[model samples]
Target: MHWSTLVDAVVVAHQPHSADPARYDIVLGAGVRSEESLFDLPAAPRFELFAGTTVAAASAGRCSAVDGLFKPRADPAPVPMELIGCEPAEPLLAALRRPRRSERNWVHLLVLDRHGAEMASRTVGLAITGARPSVLGGTLIDITLTDGGDERPSLAARPIWAQWYQGPPAEPNLWAPYDTQGRAAWLDLTTRAWRVPAPRPDRSGGEHHLDGRFVTDVPGLHCAIAEALLGPGRYFGREWNAFKDCLCGGFGVAPPFTLTWHDAEIARRALADVVEDQEDGLSYFEDIVRLLERYGVTVVLR
Candidate 1:
């Protein structure tokens, strides 16, 4: 029935060329949903790469294909991703380099069945990439699951997103205007999220971030993001408002935002007056942090 494959265990290690790739060095083990051996089975099944946490990968990078997605890192001819294995069953691990952040990476190493069919196509979670217990003092580590189990996983889930649109928005990613006729069009999006950046450039009137909390991104950074994405009306426009509205919530969808460590660090070190003001009725920023967490969105550094 099956050509039977070889190689029982799956492993990912830093490529020989990686010396300083301590942070980028990654490891992976494979598991199937059907609880079958991956070693010497079918000839060649397909594979892909995606996310555990939403922010770094595409789902975490770009949920809304039409509206707004993160800036693409195109210069590096081969960006790290969906790295398919060579054979259906004998492919070995290759070196994958990524950012040095401490975020956990939930990778889907989907292995397909031999006939290019789905009945036996398996989606496996190479769940060993992130925040697991320390092993080998390696900056990046991967391990096999002690208790064998079947694995089925789809890609990219960002900060927990609550899609509340009554109808689909004219665009993707941003909140939909109304709930679709039925809840089928949208994937209930993975606000599968988590949290950004800095500074105290004073305007004498106000600040982009105030007292250990972000009122918003710095004007310059905002300008950069806006200019790059919004263009024409960099200062104000429907697109800009939609971005803020998506985070601010209440109109329809809830605020689909989360703060990262780099973000909170800036808040904590903000001017004391800004961090906690006596005259301004306790920074609402603290409240926002708590709210994000309440939604199961972790407010921590990635």
Candidate 2:
């Protein structure tokens, strides 16, 4: 009787890290078989044997000797083998023989990024036909970035050190060290003291600490010394009123002028003069706060 046979199989190949092109190793799976060859067999053979059993034995032996099959090298690394998928041909069951050449296959290559992110994957077609051993491989992929336009000016001075003070004091304080071209500078932390640079500018420098505490070396305390004398909102409003009174007295203006007029014409000029000296000082503290934020440091500002 004549019989029809079918075979199904999957093959995979990979190059080990230590493998060199001059020498290559190949691995094969047992289930691989050719459908045309299996169909040529008779339904009832003169002798009957199990094809699966024979294939299994061959697979075991091949896998065991795989390491020895490769050329010897300074360092030999063992490559793992796997049979991912399999199927059998019907008539081939009675023959109980080794796999014919056509049924093998391999997996596609995948590329990954530096962070282990998958960048791309593509199927690589086999070059040779009816080849005995399967081949597997991989290649590296690269990423590139483009620039966008927006330019800003650089700062003349850079901050080297900064710290936030959380201890109970008049108000929250920020300390910072700045490189100001050879100028005598005193930072009021607790009090003002000279910042001495060490003999080796890079290796050592004079250090000064500031806080709310009264230190003889430092000249000024961090807190506003005349808070009680000025009272709440007194400076802001008193300065405004004084300026308005002066303007009206000078212009010979009479009463009944609206508060809005006083604010726009006279008060604005007066307040500007009062706050002029303190503007740059306040900005120094703000710059320190900005630097700390840039460095991912959390700061409590009061």
Candidate 3:
């Protein structure tokens, strides 16, 4: 598909590479870079961030009218962009020359498609928007400071969970935030094709010099959850255990945090392992759901 075909929407003026601007500070600018191939599509997408999201701008004037507890202000910062699926990438070259027609503004971005349908969207994150490694279209944005994206230079060095069993992950240790099938997947507009090394083994069986190929549980789910927790560096031994931590406490999501746990017929029987069979009460997992509500975590049991 053409690179533009892949995008659903563009939310500009975001903290470079940060999926959650509310949780992370915004870099004043995140350099965007893009390039094209004669036979293939542009390596990545590109757009410049402005002052704020349209959502924030719409609310600005209304806030001043609050009667009792209110204050008037100028240049109120834009509400942080949602990072549900986007982050910052490497900056375009330092000496970029933006087209005179391409101007920056103080607003959120959500341009519709030519068809007037919802556009394909990319999460606002760090991206390299340049034609070449050294050339830039404009003063590019930097994402090395964001915790889960290119804003933070340290992300490049983090150990991917796919190879946690090894001393360190294989060469080019980058964060693989998505689990497409069993292998780890992350967004990289630079590469000709988005492919990565195989996932680390989940177990070692009877004796063997080399590692086993089979993963103990669902590797993709684990990788996805790991990304949710900020890249793959925080892989634990088991996917289930890791999920438990997120479900109960050790992890967090955007506001109105909701967790849904599904149980099999066998899972219901396992309730014996938790609380004794309650004549009129909930199951073990259901009890956990109730407890989580006390912490303001909305858990839906299935």
Q: Which candidate leads the pack in TM-score?
A: 3
Per-residue CA lDDT of model 1 for 14-87, tens digit only, reads 35324454334334444322223334423443333333211222221211111111123344232122222223
Span of 10 residues, lowest total lDDT, candidate 2: 144-153
lDDT against the true structure, each candidate: 0.28, 0.24, 0.31
Best by lDDT: 3
lDDT of 2 at 175: 20
TM-score of 1: 0.18
Model 3 TM-score (2 dp): 0.20
> Candidate 2: global Cα-lDDT?
0.24
Candidate 1 regions off by >4 Å? Answer: 1-245, 248-259, 275-281, 284-287, 294-296
What lDDT tens digits, residue by residue, belong to model 2 across residues 1-302? 32112133223464543545644344433332223332333343342112221112111111212232123335333222221221233332222232232123223443333434333333432222221121332221121111111111123211210111222122321121222220002122221111121222211112212222221111111121111111111110112223233223322222222111111222222223322123242222333333334433343321
Which order, best to worst by TM-score?
3, 1, 2
State candidate 2's TM-score.
0.12
